[model samples]
Target chain A: MRSNSLTADLQPINKNIRKRFVLSRLHSLAGIVPLGIFMVEHLLTNSTALLGREKYNEQIHLIQSIPFLPLLEIFLVAIPLIFHAGYGIYLSMISKSNTQTYKYERNRLFFFQRVTGITTLVFIIYHVWSFRLAPVFYGTEINFDLVNSHLENVFVFSFYVIGVVGAVFHFSNGIRTGLITWGVTKGPASQRIAQRICLLFFAVFGVLGVTSLFAFI
Target chain B: MSAEKVIRLKVKRKDQMDSESYWEEFAIPYRPNMNVISALMEIQRNPVNAEGTKVRSVAWEYNCLEEVCGACSMRINGKVRQACSTLVEKLEQPIQLEPMETFPVEKDLVVDRQRMFDALQKIKGWIPIDGTYAMGSGPLISSREQQEAYKFSTCMTCGCCLDACPNVNSGSPFIGPQALAQTKYFNMHPTGKLTKNERLEVVIGDEGISNCGNSQNCVEVCPKDIPLTTALAELNHEANRYALWSWLKK
Candidate 1:
């Protein structure tokens, strides 16, 4: 009889089982923590536009003037977002969406999570580049006028709407998924309750996001 | 014997570990009501290829001629199933046999299922009895709970569910459905509930219940017709409550 050592060599080592477990848990958490919180803060800050250009620019200046703002962004927003997005891409690559065969609502929602992840990633990259970096690179005034002028273009307006919708959906749906995946909400009843709460999140954020867009107008 | 009818079979064969696998066709004397395993036995007896060339007998694994052992699971005509129960007569001609893909192929139709065992181990898939000393009888297990658990008890550790699951591939740590369902099975027992928290830690961990992609493929491919997805959902709920309780305790 052949020894099983030969078989052992063929098996791939799951070296990161512990690390992957921690990281996967953290991935779901990162979305809800600072990233989701930041989305709300960003939308609310932008909504200051409803108070007039002076108030909107003041809010921007206030945010920009916070002590150790760069460090805070790096720690809370940048690192968490990068880890969440990177791990999410790895998961999406390995995941085989089987909505056609399964056709369950949760299965469809799972598929959409990946879909929205990809779109949100693109939107985030473009959003940060145009609004944050472009101003620095061009030495343009970082004020309400600069933002409003960009939004005046129909193309930019459409892109912002799409980005907002994708981000809102990703965040809201992500909370529900994260809850289930983390074993926070286990059964159908709890999952349904979580879904309702998530839907409420979607509705609330949808209103805030759209209202924020109008502020730019 | 009425001019022996021949059954056509194509078996995926690999000579050794880390070797390229190739298909070999065999023409075996067909027997009425013979299953895939019977046809394989014929190939072993003759050791001749359909091309009329002499060859080594195909290697495969089976103990119970019945499906209860789960040792004879292989892909029959592109579907993962137990060869012992898969009747050759009911199958399409030129029956195709391949090993389950979720595990590493050892040789021919045999594959190493250490991964499945490891998953079972990770979940601690057994009830912990206090001691071997004469305890006349254990606590009464309710018939309702017994009925619910009986469905999970039928899991033969067959890789059918894992083989069908899209998440249990080489790159993934998802523990697959077989083990998850087994965790639920063990967790439901009164004796099994003692070590329940130990199992919950693994259940909520990386390779645990959360990795389920909700595809429902495992339920579809399970030979025993185990309600795998339902088991997962219930266990997932249990795991959540357990996790929250643990956190609050801390």
Candidate 2:
């Protein structure tokens, strides 16, 4: 008779078994610690446009004038964002969305989280390239005038609108799931409360982001 | 003649493993207080289709006639649940029954749930006591711990959690939520603590806790109401600590 023990079928644990866990933890940490904080700061800086062009340009000039500013951005913001985006794309590829079958609120949010992650990835790449990188290479000043002129085009404005909302949603929803992933919120009740708080975060940041765009035009 | 009442069932049937699947409709005489298992039993008894033609008897597995065995799990009305617990009265007409797609179908509603069993093996979901001989009374556990552990102890190895999980498909290497919860259950025992790191090894492996996509669907569809997502989260924390400690030691 065949043995009922399934030890033979089990995959042997390898020496590098911790690799995926380490990478996954790093991915979740990178999203909240650096990228999420940077997003909030970026939106707050842009919202200074509501105070008029001079206030906005002053904020940009203040940031650009900081000592070792390039080094700070590269080490803290750019590297973390790249790692988060790269791992996020791989995760989104492997996940199969079953919201149609399991129509729970959290399940739907899970699907949207992946969708927004990809959307935010693309938007960040284009936004950074055009506004930050292009200005550096071309020696063009990043001021209220550059952003205002760019947003004057309806299509560019619309893209920014979608991009801002998507990025904010991704960041806010990442907090909701990341709390659970890191064991900060383990039970359902705590998780539900976390969900509400994250939604509030999304609403506030979303408004600030979109309103900042309007300030640009 | 008075109109006859009937319970309509649309069953997805298969002849054998790796055979083409097809649908067969059955009209069974209405019976009060019948569950899905009894409905399938009616089809098995008469072996007749809705067209009044005889055909092969429908095949399914059921034991204990209760939800505890977990043998009669299938998708009823697009939901993965125990057929023994789902009543006919709660279902709409022409109830759709299909084998869970996560596991390979052996025939009709029966699936090869060996993957779930294999996962239990992978996690070493059992206490490692030295011998069958009488050991002294084990270390006493507080009722508080028992109450906390009891929630995870009720897992019947039902595949509903796996069926609803988006990450537990054929191509994915995930060990699913069932085994992860069982790992938590066994680790709560006094004797089980001896092999805790052994189980953590599996939890930190490639097909381990990291594979869970945090969709929380496993918790939603679980028949036992097992706190699967919570277990996954807690295990994620435990595994991370373990991994960090091992790295520091080296």
Candidate 3:
């Protein structure tokens, strides 16, 4: 018998499994839907540098020219990232990393997920601050030279490299786990297939991110 | 001031399965060396609240008054433990008691722990044998194996591990530490290995070992001090190998 009446005076205990299911599903969806898409768009836009300096500047101008840019940033990128990062931090805080206790592959992956999540959040903040906000606040022209000047600093370039790698792992590993958590891949064979697909994703995106980083050089 | 000391207890109570639960505070004459179960018994006798009103007797369950049997497991001072072992003298004042949330409360303090048992069944947590007819001497187990198995054998199915596990909440389908440890125990036995692949199949799935978030809280609250996290770790490794083997065979 599923008792629906369990209560704690201080906290309202959730007896509904559906609420938890929805929250978990939403957390996984947020990782993919807009956040992952945003990463793709950001990388593709930056890759315009490979074509020419003018092409890269034009791409940046095109993004700046979009109607209601601030609104789109808020609704599409910032909000979803905040939600994803906030919920992800909460999950990491509650989770106990047992890599020391359990040296299994999945156990290590679980620990790595939390580590990369924290790094990714820090990287994303640093990236947005340096690239997006600093230019507006400093009243500097947004151009390929600005991007190249920032990448000229060794430390700044290192941060981008590490951040890009962290983002790739987080996104790729997240997809593999999301497939399982959502019940999309239930068996070992299906999970292996999903893992291979995620690895391929990591490879493709890793190349794009690294290529974009080098384009600024 | 000529007054008698009183024990204050706040218990979460529900009359029926679907009814809303309410908190009721009770004050009983302080008895020296009394445990939570004893105070609960006093409440049963008096059936009065701290508000100076008559109330229904608080319902609870118990079998062995000692730590064994595991039937009297409940939240004592917000920590899931066996009520029989928690001394009211040792607990902080205004002892807060609640039913374990991981299971459905069948009454005020008693919960239906059938899910844990169901998980045990799913893992085939017992040794398989042909019949009760006397077989000759069983396969020899090393002293180390026996010692390791003994630790897991002490698990009373108390549900404390599940209660402390963040991953084993009602919404999740995690089979929890208790059953996972038990699965390892049985799988270690000579005869139990006959069905090792069957047990491994259950754990390699979504509801099995994969669901464990490795919170490590389960090991801390285990009444018997079973190496739950260690067993889960070992089981995870074993399950991985078994999964690959199955895939290759397929």
Which candidate leads in TM-score?
2
Candidates sorted by lDDT, best first? 2, 1, 3
- DockQ ranking, high to low: 2, 1, 3
Candidate 1 residue lDDT tens string, A42-70: 98888788888999988998999999997
CA deviation > 4 Å runs, candidate 2: A1-14, B131-135
User: Which ten contiguous residues of candidate 3 chain A have the minimum total lDDT?
Assistant: A6-15
TM-scores, all candidates, are 0.69, 0.95, 0.62
**Residue A126: error of model 1 in Å?**
2.2
Q: Tens-digit lDDT track for model 1 on B176-250? A: 899889988888898888877777777777777767766567877788989887778777677667766766777
| lDDT: worst 10-residue window of model 2 chain A | A1-10
Q: What are the runs in model 3 whose C-alpha is more than 4 Å off?
A: A1-217, B131-135
Q: What is the TM-score (0 to 1) of chain A in model 1? A: 0.89
User: By TM-score, is 1 or 2 better?
Assistant: 2
Worst ten-residue run, lDDT, model 2 chain B?
B123-132
Name the docking class for model 3: incorrect
Clashing pairs in 1: A186-B237
Q: Which is the leading candidate under DockQ?
A: 2
Cα deviation of A88 in candidate 1 (Å)? 2.3
lDDT of 3 by residue, B22-90 (tens): 999999999899999999999999999999899989999999998989998998877889999999999
| Better structure of 1 and 3 per lDDT | 1
